[model samples]
Target: MPHNSIPVIETKRLVLRGPEAGDYPDFRATFSSYRSRFMGGPLTPYETWMLYAAEIGHWQIRGYGMWMIHDRTTDKPLGMAGGWKPAQWPEAEIAWIIWPETAGHGYALEATHAARGYLYGRLGWEGAVSYLDPKNLDSIRLAERLGAKKDTGAQTVDGNDICYRHPSPAQLKNTQISDGIELEIAHYADPKFRPEGYALD
Candidate 1:
Protein backbone atom coordinates (compact mmCIF):
# COMPACT_ATOMS: atom_id res chain seq x y z
CA MET A 1 0.00 0.00 0.00
CA PRO A 2 1.08 3.57 -0.53
CA HIS A 3 2.35 5.06 2.73
CA ASN A 4 -0.11 7.95 2.60
CA SER A 5 -2.94 5.47 2.57
CA ILE A 6 -2.16 4.09 6.01
CA PRO A 7 -5.38 3.59 7.97
CA VAL A 8 -6.37 5.68 10.97
CA ILE A 9 -8.04 3.92 13.87
CA GLU A 10 -10.28 5.46 16.51
CA THR A 11 -11.57 4.30 19.85
CA LYS A 12 -13.78 5.76 22.54
CA ARG A 13 -11.08 8.09 23.78
CA LEU A 14 -8.23 7.96 21.31
CA VAL A 15 -7.23 8.10 17.67
CA LEU A 16 -4.49 5.85 16.38
CA ARG A 17 -3.18 7.25 13.14
CA GLY A 18 -0.04 7.57 11.07
CA PRO A 19 2.84 9.60 12.47
CA GLU A 20 3.07 13.26 11.65
CA ALA A 21 5.87 15.81 11.95
CA GLY A 22 3.84 17.62 14.60
CA ASP A 23 4.16 14.70 16.98
CA TYR A 24 7.90 15.30 17.40
CA PRO A 25 7.74 17.39 20.56
CA ASP A 26 5.86 14.72 22.50
CA PHE A 27 8.12 12.08 21.02
CA ARG A 28 11.22 13.97 22.09
CA ALA A 29 9.93 14.68 25.59
CA THR A 30 8.99 11.06 26.17
CA PHE A 31 12.22 9.57 24.87
CA SER A 32 14.48 12.08 26.60
CA SER A 33 13.52 10.82 30.02
CA TYR A 34 14.63 7.84 32.08
CA ARG A 35 11.24 6.28 31.29
CA SER A 36 12.73 5.60 27.88
CA ARG A 37 15.49 3.41 29.27
CA PHE A 38 13.89 0.28 27.89
CA MET A 39 12.99 1.91 24.57
CA GLY A 40 16.52 2.83 23.35
CA GLY A 41 16.36 6.44 24.38
CA PRO A 42 17.86 9.33 26.34
CA LEU A 43 18.99 9.86 22.78
CA THR A 44 20.58 12.99 21.38
CA PRO A 45 18.22 15.40 19.62
CA TYR A 46 19.56 14.35 16.25
CA GLU A 47 19.12 10.72 17.15
CA THR A 48 15.56 11.37 18.30
CA TRP A 49 14.83 13.05 14.99
CA MET A 50 16.23 10.05 13.19
CA LEU A 51 14.11 7.77 15.32
CA TYR A 52 10.97 9.75 14.44
CA ALA A 53 11.94 9.61 10.80
CA ALA A 54 12.49 5.91 11.08
CA GLU A 55 8.99 5.48 12.53
CA ILE A 56 7.55 7.15 9.48
CA GLY A 57 9.74 5.09 7.21
CA HIS A 58 8.66 1.93 8.94
CA TRP A 59 5.03 2.47 7.87
CA GLN A 60 6.08 3.13 4.30
CA ILE A 61 8.18 0.01 4.15
CA ARG A 62 6.06 -2.41 6.16
CA GLY A 63 2.45 -1.33 5.45
CA TYR A 64 1.73 -1.53 9.17
CA GLY A 65 3.69 0.24 11.90
CA MET A 66 3.14 2.22 15.07
CA TRP A 67 0.32 4.76 15.23
CA MET A 68 0.62 8.20 16.78
CA ILE A 69 -1.95 8.04 19.56
CA HIS A 70 -4.10 11.09 20.27
CA ASP A 71 -6.55 11.99 22.97
CA ARG A 72 -9.78 12.21 21.02
CA THR A 73 -11.30 14.79 23.34
CA THR A 74 -8.36 17.14 23.59
CA ASP A 75 -7.07 16.41 20.11
CA LYS A 76 -3.56 16.19 21.53
CA PRO A 77 -0.89 13.67 20.80
CA LEU A 78 -0.51 11.24 23.69
CA GLY A 79 2.06 8.78 22.34
CA MET A 80 2.20 5.76 20.04
CA ALA A 81 0.65 2.29 19.91
CA GLY A 82 0.43 -0.39 17.21
CA GLY A 83 2.21 -3.16 15.31
CA TRP A 84 5.95 -3.24 14.73
CA LYS A 85 8.27 -5.69 12.99
CA PRO A 86 11.76 -4.56 12.27
CA ALA A 87 14.00 -6.72 10.09
CA GLN A 88 15.25 -8.97 12.85
CA TRP A 89 12.03 -9.43 14.78
CA PRO A 90 10.75 -12.98 15.30
CA GLU A 91 7.21 -11.84 14.58
CA ALA A 92 5.11 -8.72 14.22
CA GLU A 93 4.74 -7.13 17.66
CA ILE A 94 2.12 -5.01 19.40
CA ALA A 95 3.73 -2.02 21.13
CA TRP A 96 2.74 1.10 23.04
CA ILE A 97 4.19 4.10 24.90
CA ILE A 98 2.22 6.84 26.63
CA TRP A 99 3.58 10.18 27.77
CA PRO A 100 4.52 10.27 31.47
CA GLU A 101 1.82 12.70 32.58
CA THR A 102 -0.74 10.61 30.78
CA ALA A 103 0.36 7.40 32.45
CA GLY A 104 -1.93 5.21 34.56
CA HIS A 105 -5.34 6.15 33.21
CA GLY A 106 -5.64 3.00 31.03
CA TYR A 107 -4.75 4.73 27.78
CA ALA A 108 -2.13 2.16 26.94
CA LEU A 109 -4.54 -0.62 27.53
CA GLU A 110 -7.24 1.09 25.49
CA ALA A 111 -4.99 1.95 22.58
CA THR A 112 -3.25 -1.39 22.54
CA HIS A 113 -6.53 -3.28 22.55
CA ALA A 114 -7.72 -1.27 19.58
CA ALA A 115 -4.44 -1.68 17.75
CA ARG A 116 -4.37 -5.42 18.34
CA GLY A 117 -7.97 -5.61 17.12
CA TYR A 118 -6.98 -3.87 13.92
CA LEU A 119 -4.09 -6.25 13.46
CA TYR A 120 -6.25 -9.30 13.93
CA GLY A 121 -9.57 -8.13 12.56
CA ARG A 122 -8.62 -5.76 9.78
CA LEU A 123 -5.34 -7.42 8.89
CA GLY A 124 -6.11 -11.07 9.46
CA TRP A 125 -3.13 -11.70 11.67
CA GLU A 126 -3.13 -15.00 13.51
CA GLY A 127 -1.28 -13.44 16.43
CA ALA A 128 1.27 -10.88 17.52
CA VAL A 129 3.89 -10.57 20.25
CA SER A 130 5.34 -7.87 22.41
CA TYR A 131 9.08 -7.66 22.99
CA LEU A 132 9.32 -6.34 26.50
CA ASP A 133 12.20 -5.62 28.80
CA PRO A 134 11.72 -7.87 31.80
CA LYS A 135 12.46 -4.98 34.12
CA ASN A 136 9.57 -2.94 32.72
CA LEU A 137 7.04 -4.07 35.30
CA ASP A 138 4.26 -1.82 34.09
CA SER A 139 4.46 -3.22 30.59
CA ILE A 140 4.56 -6.74 31.95
CA ARG A 141 1.37 -6.08 33.86
CA LEU A 142 -0.29 -4.49 30.86
CA ALA A 143 0.70 -7.39 28.65
CA GLU A 144 -0.81 -9.79 31.15
CA ARG A 145 -4.01 -7.77 31.28
CA LEU A 146 -4.16 -7.91 27.51
CA GLY A 147 -3.97 -11.69 27.71
CA ALA A 148 -0.41 -11.88 26.49
CA LYS A 149 1.80 -14.50 28.08
CA LYS A 150 5.55 -14.71 28.11
CA ASP A 151 6.77 -17.04 25.41
CA THR A 152 9.70 -18.53 27.28
CA GLY A 153 11.06 -20.04 24.10
CA ALA A 154 11.09 -16.85 22.08
CA GLN A 155 13.96 -14.33 21.96
CA THR A 156 14.54 -10.90 20.51
CA VAL A 157 17.17 -9.82 18.02
CA ASP A 158 19.08 -8.05 20.77
CA GLY A 159 18.76 -11.19 22.90
CA ASN A 160 17.73 -9.21 25.99
CA ASP A 161 14.00 -8.66 25.53
CA ILE A 162 11.40 -11.30 26.40
CA CYS A 163 8.56 -12.04 24.03
CA TYR A 164 4.94 -11.89 25.20
CA ARG A 165 2.58 -13.58 22.79
CA HIS A 166 -0.88 -12.09 22.44
CA PRO A 167 -4.09 -14.09 22.05
CA SER A 168 -5.45 -14.80 18.60
CA PRO A 169 -8.72 -13.22 17.42
CA ALA A 170 -10.73 -16.24 18.50
CA GLN A 171 -9.33 -15.97 22.00
CA LEU A 172 -10.21 -12.32 22.50
CA LYS A 173 -13.30 -11.69 24.62
CA ASN A 174 -15.50 -8.79 25.83
CA THR A 175 -13.79 -6.23 23.57
CA GLN A 176 -16.85 -4.25 22.58
CA ILE A 177 -16.73 -0.46 22.72
CA SER A 178 -18.29 0.88 25.88
CA ASP A 179 -21.04 3.53 26.06
CA GLY A 180 -19.92 6.92 24.72
CA ILE A 181 -16.82 5.40 23.17
CA GLU A 182 -16.27 4.78 19.46
CA LEU A 183 -13.84 2.71 17.43
CA GLU A 184 -13.34 3.75 13.83
CA ILE A 185 -11.12 2.25 11.12
CA ALA A 186 -10.22 4.59 8.30
CA HIS A 187 -11.42 3.51 4.89
CA TYR A 188 -8.82 2.86 2.25
CA ALA A 189 -10.05 1.64 -1.14
CA ASP A 190 -6.88 0.23 -2.59
CA PRO A 191 -4.96 -1.20 0.30
CA LYS A 192 -2.11 -3.36 -0.93
CA PHE A 193 -3.81 -6.36 0.60
CA ARG A 194 -7.52 -6.55 1.18
CA PRO A 195 -8.48 -7.78 4.61
CA GLU A 196 -10.28 -11.08 4.95
CA GLY A 197 -13.48 -11.05 7.04
CA TYR A 198 -12.27 -11.21 10.62
CA ALA A 199 -13.59 -9.61 13.80
CA LEU A 200 -11.63 -9.34 17.03
CA ASP A 201 -14.72 -9.24 19.18
Candidate 2:
Protein backbone atom coordinates (compact mmCIF):
# COMPACT_ATOMS: atom_id res chain seq x y z
CA MET A 1 0.00 0.00 0.00
CA PRO A 2 1.09 3.54 -0.61
CA HIS A 3 2.28 5.44 2.44
CA ASN A 4 -0.83 7.64 2.40
CA SER A 5 -2.98 4.54 2.27
CA ILE A 6 -2.01 3.21 5.64
CA PRO A 7 -4.44 0.58 6.92
CA VAL A 8 -6.94 1.10 9.74
CA ILE A 9 -7.21 -1.61 12.39
CA GLU A 10 -10.23 -2.11 14.64
CA THR A 11 -10.74 -4.14 17.75
CA LYS A 12 -13.67 -5.04 19.97
CA ARG A 13 -13.89 -1.62 21.59
CA LEU A 14 -11.38 0.51 19.71
CA VAL A 15 -10.65 1.73 16.19
CA LEU A 16 -7.02 2.18 15.18
CA ARG A 17 -6.67 4.73 12.38
CA GLY A 18 -4.12 7.19 11.10
CA PRO A 19 -3.36 10.14 13.33
CA GLU A 20 -5.26 13.35 12.63
CA ALA A 21 -4.49 16.99 13.32
CA GLY A 22 -7.34 17.11 15.82
CA ASP A 23 -5.79 14.41 18.00
CA TYR A 24 -2.95 16.72 18.98
CA PRO A 25 -4.74 17.95 22.11
CA ASP A 26 -5.16 14.47 23.59
CA PHE A 27 -1.70 13.44 22.43
CA ARG A 28 -0.24 16.49 24.07
CA ALA A 29 -2.16 15.85 27.25
CA THR A 30 -0.74 12.36 27.56
CA PHE A 31 2.84 13.42 26.95
CA SER A 32 2.63 16.32 29.37
CA SER A 33 1.40 14.23 32.28
CA TYR A 34 3.20 11.95 34.70
CA ARG A 35 1.71 9.00 32.80
CA SER A 36 4.15 9.76 30.02
CA ARG A 37 7.16 9.37 32.29
CA PHE A 38 8.05 5.95 30.99
CA MET A 39 7.71 7.03 27.38
CA GLY A 40 10.20 9.90 27.71
CA GLY A 41 7.55 12.52 28.30
CA PRO A 42 6.74 15.37 30.68
CA LEU A 43 7.78 17.52 27.73
CA THR A 44 6.94 21.10 26.80
CA PRO A 45 4.06 21.74 24.38
CA TYR A 46 6.48 22.59 21.57
CA GLU A 47 8.37 19.36 22.12
CA THR A 48 5.12 17.43 22.22
CA TRP A 49 4.07 19.05 18.97
CA MET A 50 7.35 17.95 17.42
CA LEU A 51 6.80 14.39 18.64
CA TYR A 52 3.24 14.39 17.31
CA ALA A 53 4.43 15.62 13.95
CA ALA A 54 7.09 12.93 13.87
CA GLU A 55 4.39 10.32 14.44
CA ILE A 56 2.48 11.53 11.39
CA GLY A 57 5.71 11.86 9.42
CA HIS A 58 6.74 8.31 10.29
CA TRP A 59 4.09 6.89 8.00
CA GLN A 60 5.40 8.95 5.11
CA ILE A 61 9.02 8.01 5.73
CA ARG A 62 8.80 4.52 7.25
CA GLY A 63 5.48 3.41 5.66
CA TYR A 64 4.18 2.43 9.10
CA GLY A 65 3.76 4.08 12.46
CA MET A 66 1.38 4.53 15.38
CA TRP A 67 -2.38 4.81 14.92
CA MET A 68 -4.71 7.11 16.78
CA ILE A 69 -6.86 4.77 18.87
CA HIS A 70 -10.52 5.73 19.24
CA ASP A 71 -13.43 4.28 21.11
CA ARG A 72 -15.52 2.38 18.62
CA THR A 73 -18.80 3.30 20.22
CA THR A 74 -18.22 6.93 21.06
CA ASP A 75 -15.55 7.87 18.52
CA LYS A 76 -13.44 9.36 21.27
CA PRO A 77 -9.71 9.16 20.82
CA LEU A 78 -8.04 7.08 23.51
CA GLY A 79 -4.39 7.14 22.57
CA MET A 80 -1.99 5.51 20.10
CA ALA A 81 -0.93 1.98 19.19
CA GLY A 82 1.04 0.38 16.35
CA GLY A 83 4.52 -0.41 14.96
CA TRP A 84 7.43 1.91 15.77
CA LYS A 85 10.92 1.53 14.29
CA PRO A 86 12.99 4.68 14.32
CA ALA A 87 16.40 4.94 12.67
CA GLN A 88 18.10 4.32 15.98
CA TRP A 89 15.96 1.36 17.00
CA PRO A 90 17.09 -2.24 17.09
CA GLU A 91 14.03 -3.69 15.31
CA ALA A 92 10.39 -3.02 14.50
CA GLU A 93 8.46 -2.70 17.71
CA ILE A 94 4.77 -2.80 18.64
CA ALA A 95 4.03 0.03 21.08
CA TRP A 96 0.97 1.39 22.85
CA ILE A 97 -0.05 4.22 25.18
CA ILE A 98 -3.62 4.55 26.47
CA TRP A 99 -4.91 7.82 27.86
CA PRO A 100 -5.24 8.08 31.62
CA GLU A 101 -9.02 7.73 31.61
CA THR A 102 -8.78 4.63 29.44
CA ALA A 103 -5.68 3.15 30.97
CA GLY A 104 -7.10 0.21 32.96
CA HIS A 105 -9.80 -0.94 30.58
CA GLY A 106 -7.75 -3.44 28.52
CA TYR A 107 -7.85 -1.18 25.44
CA ALA A 108 -4.10 -1.50 24.97
CA LEU A 109 -4.26 -5.28 24.92
CA GLU A 110 -7.12 -5.34 22.42
CA ALA A 111 -5.72 -2.66 20.10
CA THR A 112 -2.20 -4.09 20.26
CA HIS A 113 -3.44 -7.54 19.32
CA ALA A 114 -4.97 -6.09 16.18
CA ALA A 115 -1.84 -4.01 15.45
CA ARG A 116 0.44 -7.03 15.80
CA GLY A 117 -1.82 -9.10 13.57
CA TYR A 118 -1.58 -6.44 10.88
CA LEU A 119 2.18 -6.26 11.31
CA TYR A 120 2.75 -9.98 11.11
CA GLY A 121 -0.08 -11.30 8.95
CA ARG A 122 -0.69 -8.42 6.57
CA LEU A 123 2.73 -6.74 6.54
CA GLY A 124 4.66 -10.06 6.44
CA TRP A 125 6.90 -9.15 9.30
CA GLU A 126 8.82 -12.09 10.70
CA GLY A 127 8.52 -10.73 14.22
CA ALA A 128 8.68 -7.57 16.27
CA VAL A 129 9.84 -6.51 19.71
CA SER A 130 8.77 -3.91 22.30
CA TYR A 131 11.49 -1.83 23.90
CA LEU A 132 10.32 -1.09 27.43
CA ASP A 133 11.80 0.86 30.26
CA PRO A 134 12.99 -1.34 33.11
CA LYS A 135 10.76 0.40 35.64
CA ASN A 136 7.60 0.29 33.55
CA LEU A 137 6.05 -2.61 35.41
CA ASP A 138 2.63 -2.08 33.86
CA SER A 139 4.04 -2.41 30.35
CA ILE A 140 6.11 -5.42 31.39
CA ARG A 141 2.98 -7.14 32.69
CA LEU A 142 1.08 -6.25 29.55
CA ALA A 143 3.88 -7.69 27.42
CA GLU A 144 3.77 -10.91 29.37
CA ARG A 145 0.05 -11.16 28.75
CA LEU A 146 0.65 -10.71 25.04
CA GLY A 147 2.98 -13.74 25.02
CA ALA A 148 6.07 -11.59 24.69
CA LYS A 149 9.08 -13.02 26.44
CA LYS A 150 11.98 -11.03 27.72
CA ASP A 151 14.94 -11.12 25.36
CA THR A 152 17.67 -10.51 27.86
CA GLY A 153 20.39 -10.57 25.25
CA ALA A 154 18.71 -8.09 22.93
CA GLN A 155 20.28 -4.66 22.60
CA THR A 156 18.39 -1.36 22.40
CA VAL A 157 19.45 2.14 21.38
CA ASP A 158 18.96 3.08 24.98
CA GLY A 159 21.19 0.89 27.08
CA ASN A 160 18.82 1.03 30.02
CA ASP A 161 15.85 -0.49 28.19
CA ILE A 162 14.93 -4.14 27.69
CA CYS A 163 13.40 -5.88 24.70
CA TYR A 164 10.18 -7.92 24.82
CA ARG A 165 9.94 -10.24 21.87
CA HIS A 166 6.40 -10.83 20.62
CA PRO A 167 5.09 -14.16 19.41
CA SER A 168 5.23 -15.02 15.74
CA PRO A 169 2.09 -14.87 13.59
CA ALA A 170 1.45 -18.56 13.97
CA GLN A 171 1.53 -18.24 17.72
CA LEU A 172 -0.88 -15.30 18.03
CA LYS A 173 -4.28 -16.23 19.38
CA ASN A 174 -7.25 -15.39 17.20
CA THR A 175 -9.02 -12.18 18.28
CA GLN A 176 -11.90 -13.56 20.29
CA ILE A 177 -15.00 -11.45 20.79
CA SER A 178 -16.43 -11.12 24.24
CA ASP A 179 -19.24 -8.92 25.56
CA GLY A 180 -20.13 -7.98 21.96
CA ILE A 181 -16.60 -6.72 21.13
CA GLU A 182 -15.27 -7.09 17.57
CA LEU A 183 -12.14 -6.23 15.53
CA GLU A 184 -11.77 -4.87 11.98
CA ILE A 185 -8.92 -3.76 9.67
CA ALA A 186 -9.49 -0.81 7.32
CA HIS A 187 -8.22 -0.70 3.73
CA TYR A 188 -6.99 2.63 2.48
CA ALA A 189 -8.69 2.43 -0.90
CA ASP A 190 -12.11 1.70 0.49
CA PRO A 191 -14.09 4.83 1.19
CA LYS A 192 -16.49 2.65 3.17
CA PHE A 193 -13.65 1.25 5.26
CA ARG A 194 -15.63 1.01 8.45
CA PRO A 195 -16.40 -2.59 9.42
CA GLU A 196 -19.56 -4.11 10.79
CA GLY A 197 -20.17 -5.23 14.38
CA TYR A 198 -19.31 -1.80 15.78
CA ALA A 199 -21.43 1.35 15.78
CA LEU A 200 -18.78 3.70 14.39
CA ASP A 201 -21.38 6.04 12.88
Candidate 3:
Protein backbone atom coordinates (compact mmCIF):
# COMPACT_ATOMS: atom_id res chain seq x y z
CA MET A 1 0.00 0.00 0.00
CA PRO A 2 1.13 3.54 -0.67
CA HIS A 3 2.20 5.34 2.45
CA ASN A 4 -0.39 8.01 1.92
CA SER A 5 -3.23 5.79 0.86
CA ILE A 6 -5.34 7.79 3.24
CA PRO A 7 -8.98 8.22 2.37
CA VAL A 8 -10.46 11.14 0.50
CA ILE A 9 -13.30 12.80 2.42
CA GLU A 10 -15.88 15.11 0.87
CA THR A 11 -17.94 17.63 2.76
CA LYS A 12 -20.78 19.87 1.58
CA ARG A 13 -18.33 22.51 0.37
CA LEU A 14 -14.89 20.98 0.76
CA VAL A 15 -12.91 17.93 -0.23
CA LEU A 16 -10.05 16.48 1.81
CA ARG A 17 -7.43 14.38 0.08
CA GLY A 18 -3.94 13.03 0.64
CA PRO A 19 -1.12 15.56 0.42
CA GLU A 20 0.69 16.05 -2.86
CA ALA A 21 3.79 17.76 -4.19
CA GLY A 22 1.69 20.66 -5.41
CA ASP A 23 0.56 21.36 -1.86
CA TYR A 24 4.01 22.37 -0.61
CA PRO A 25 4.18 26.01 -1.75
CA ASP A 26 0.78 26.95 -0.29
CA PHE A 27 1.66 25.14 2.90
CA ARG A 28 5.07 26.75 2.90
CA ALA A 29 3.67 30.26 2.55
CA THR A 30 1.03 29.75 5.23
CA PHE A 31 3.42 28.05 7.60
CA SER A 32 6.05 30.72 7.21
CA SER A 33 3.61 33.56 7.78
CA TYR A 34 2.07 34.94 10.95
CA ARG A 35 -0.99 32.89 10.13
CA SER A 36 0.75 29.78 11.39
CA ARG A 37 1.57 31.41 14.72
CA PHE A 38 -0.26 28.91 16.85
CA MET A 39 1.29 25.97 15.04
CA GLY A 40 4.86 26.81 16.11
CA GLY A 41 5.56 28.48 12.84
CA PRO A 42 7.33 31.51 11.34
CA LEU A 43 9.85 28.77 10.61
CA THR A 44 12.88 29.02 8.33
CA PRO A 45 12.64 27.91 4.69
CA TYR A 46 14.56 24.72 5.47
CA GLU A 47 12.36 23.99 8.44
CA THR A 48 9.29 24.54 6.32
CA TRP A 49 10.57 22.08 3.72
CA MET A 50 11.36 19.51 6.34
CA LEU A 51 7.96 19.90 7.99
CA TYR A 52 6.20 19.40 4.69
CA ALA A 53 8.13 16.18 4.16
CA ALA A 54 7.39 15.13 7.70
CA GLU A 55 3.66 15.63 7.23
CA ILE A 56 3.72 13.43 4.17
CA GLY A 57 6.14 11.08 5.86
CA HIS A 58 3.71 10.81 8.75
CA TRP A 59 1.37 8.76 6.62
CA GLN A 60 4.27 6.48 5.70
CA ILE A 61 5.46 5.99 9.25
CA ARG A 62 2.17 6.10 11.16
CA GLY A 63 -0.35 4.92 8.53
CA TYR A 64 -2.60 7.91 9.27
CA GLY A 65 -1.92 11.61 8.91
CA MET A 66 -3.38 14.96 7.93
CA TRP A 67 -5.17 15.36 4.64
CA MET A 68 -5.17 18.48 2.49
CA ILE A 69 -8.46 20.35 2.36
CA HIS A 70 -9.64 21.80 -0.94
CA ASP A 71 -12.56 23.64 -2.49
CA ARG A 72 -15.02 21.05 -3.82
CA THR A 73 -15.46 22.62 -7.24
CA THR A 74 -12.45 24.85 -7.83
CA ASP A 75 -10.12 22.26 -6.31
CA LYS A 76 -8.20 25.09 -4.74
CA PRO A 77 -6.17 24.25 -1.67
CA LEU A 78 -7.67 25.44 1.58
CA GLY A 79 -5.78 23.87 4.47
CA MET A 80 -5.47 20.58 6.32
CA ALA A 81 -7.22 18.42 8.94
CA GLY A 82 -6.80 14.91 10.36
CA GLY A 83 -5.19 12.75 13.06
CA TRP A 84 -1.62 13.28 14.26
CA LYS A 85 0.74 11.89 16.89
CA PRO A 86 4.50 11.97 17.11
CA ALA A 87 6.78 9.77 19.22
CA GLN A 88 7.08 12.34 21.99
CA TRP A 89 3.33 12.95 22.19
CA PRO A 90 1.33 11.39 24.99
CA GLU A 91 -1.69 10.71 22.77
CA ALA A 92 -3.03 10.93 19.25
CA GLU A 93 -4.74 14.14 18.15
CA ILE A 94 -7.18 15.32 15.53
CA ALA A 95 -5.65 18.55 14.22
CA TRP A 96 -6.90 21.21 11.83
CA ILE A 97 -5.49 24.31 10.06
CA ILE A 98 -7.21 26.73 7.70
CA TRP A 99 -5.60 29.71 5.99
CA PRO A 100 -6.51 33.07 7.50
CA GLU A 101 -7.84 34.46 4.23
CA THR A 102 -10.33 31.61 4.07
CA ALA A 103 -11.18 31.91 7.73
CA GLY A 104 -14.84 32.99 7.71
CA HIS A 105 -16.37 30.24 5.58
CA GLY A 106 -16.49 27.42 8.13
CA TYR A 107 -14.19 25.27 5.96
CA ALA A 108 -12.22 24.08 8.95
CA LEU A 109 -15.31 22.95 10.78
CA GLU A 110 -16.63 21.01 7.82
CA ALA A 111 -13.27 19.39 7.07
CA THR A 112 -12.79 18.57 10.72
CA HIS A 113 -16.15 16.90 10.98
CA ALA A 114 -15.25 14.73 8.02
CA ALA A 115 -11.90 13.94 9.63
CA ARG A 116 -13.56 13.01 12.92
CA GLY A 117 -16.01 10.73 11.20
CA TYR A 118 -13.13 8.97 9.44
CA LEU A 119 -11.28 8.56 12.70
CA TYR A 120 -14.29 6.88 14.25
CA GLY A 121 -16.11 5.10 11.43
CA ARG A 122 -13.12 3.98 9.40
CA LEU A 123 -10.25 3.94 11.87
CA GLY A 124 -12.22 2.70 14.89
CA TRP A 125 -10.77 5.22 17.28
CA GLU A 126 -12.39 5.19 20.71
CA GLY A 127 -12.14 8.97 20.92
CA ALA A 128 -10.01 11.87 19.72
CA VAL A 129 -8.36 14.99 21.08
CA SER A 130 -7.22 18.31 19.64
CA TYR A 131 -4.18 20.05 21.09
CA LEU A 132 -4.34 23.80 20.74
CA ASP A 133 -2.55 26.91 21.85
CA PRO A 134 -4.38 28.60 24.69
CA LYS A 135 -4.32 31.83 22.67
CA ASN A 136 -5.91 30.30 19.60
CA LEU A 137 -9.44 31.32 20.43
CA ASP A 138 -10.75 30.54 16.95
CA SER A 139 -9.72 26.91 17.18
CA ILE A 140 -11.03 26.70 20.73
CA ARG A 141 -14.42 27.88 19.55
CA LEU A 142 -14.25 25.49 16.62
CA ALA A 143 -13.46 22.62 18.98
CA GLU A 144 -16.43 23.48 21.12
CA ARG A 145 -18.62 23.67 18.05
CA LEU A 146 -17.46 20.19 17.10
CA GLY A 147 -18.62 18.96 20.53
CA ALA A 148 -15.12 18.89 22.06
CA LYS A 149 -14.57 19.97 25.62
CA LYS A 150 -11.41 21.15 27.27
CA ASP A 151 -9.60 18.28 28.96
CA THR A 152 -7.63 19.83 31.75
CA GLY A 153 -6.69 16.37 32.89
CA ALA A 154 -5.17 15.33 29.59
CA GLN A 155 -1.46 15.64 28.85
CA THR A 156 -0.40 18.04 26.15
CA VAL A 157 2.11 17.32 23.38
CA ASP A 158 3.96 20.51 24.18
CA GLY A 159 4.07 22.19 27.56
CA ASN A 160 2.36 25.25 26.11
CA ASP A 161 -0.60 23.59 24.42
CA ILE A 162 -4.00 22.71 25.89
CA CYS A 163 -6.03 19.60 25.20
CA TYR A 164 -9.63 19.42 24.00
CA ARG A 165 -11.29 16.01 23.99
CA HIS A 166 -13.82 15.30 21.31
CA PRO A 167 -17.13 13.58 21.84
CA SER A 168 -17.33 9.81 21.73
CA PRO A 169 -18.69 7.95 18.74
CA ALA A 170 -22.07 7.49 20.38
CA GLN A 171 -22.19 11.16 21.27
CA LEU A 172 -21.10 12.13 17.81
CA LYS A 173 -23.88 10.01 16.36
CA ASN A 174 -26.37 11.92 18.43
CA THR A 175 -25.18 15.37 17.32
CA GLN A 176 -25.94 16.64 13.86
CA ILE A 177 -23.01 17.78 11.73
CA SER A 178 -23.21 19.88 8.56
CA ASP A 179 -26.38 19.22 6.60
CA GLY A 180 -26.35 17.23 3.34
CA ILE A 181 -22.67 16.28 3.25
CA GLU A 182 -22.35 12.65 2.22
CA LEU A 183 -19.09 11.64 3.88
CA GLU A 184 -18.69 8.33 2.07
CA ILE A 185 -15.26 7.27 3.31
CA ALA A 186 -13.40 5.39 0.64
CA HIS A 187 -11.91 1.87 0.80
CA TYR A 188 -14.08 0.44 3.54
CA ALA A 189 -12.95 -3.03 4.77
CA ASP A 190 -9.85 -2.75 2.59
CA PRO A 191 -6.86 -3.95 4.57
CA LYS A 192 -4.26 -3.15 1.97
CA PHE A 193 -3.94 0.11 3.83
CA ARG A 194 -4.96 -0.71 7.35
CA PRO A 195 -5.02 2.44 9.49
CA GLU A 196 -3.49 1.19 12.69
CA GLY A 197 -5.68 3.06 15.14
CA TYR A 198 -4.19 6.26 16.62
CA ALA A 199 -1.70 4.49 18.84
CA LEU A 200 1.78 5.96 19.17
CA ASP A 201 4.43 3.46 18.31
Best by TM-score: 3
Per-residue accuracy of model 3 over 1-201 as CA lDDT, tens digit each? 285467889876778999999988899999999988999998999999999999998888888899999999999998999999889888889999987667655677778888989989998999989999999888898888777899999988877999999888887774464222222112211345433542110
Report the CA-based lDDT of candidate 2 relative to the real structure.
0.80
Candidate ordering by TM-score (highest first): 3, 1, 2
Clashing pairs in 3: none
Better of 1 and 3 by lDDT: 3
- Cα error, candidate 1, residue 175 (Å): 8.7
Error of 1 at 149 (Å): 0.3
Q: Could you give candidate 2's per-residue lDDT for residues 110-171 as a string of tens digits?
A: 78877887888888999899999989888887787677889989888689889999877766
Candidate 3, residue 94: how far the Cα is off, in Å: 0.5
- What Cα-based lDDT does every candidate model obtain? 0.79, 0.80, 0.81
Give me the runs in candidate 3 sitting further than 4 Å from their true place: 176-201
Cα deviation of 94, candidate 1, in Å = 0.6
Listed in order, each prediction's TM-score against the native is 0.84, 0.84, 0.85
- TM-score, prediction 2: 0.84
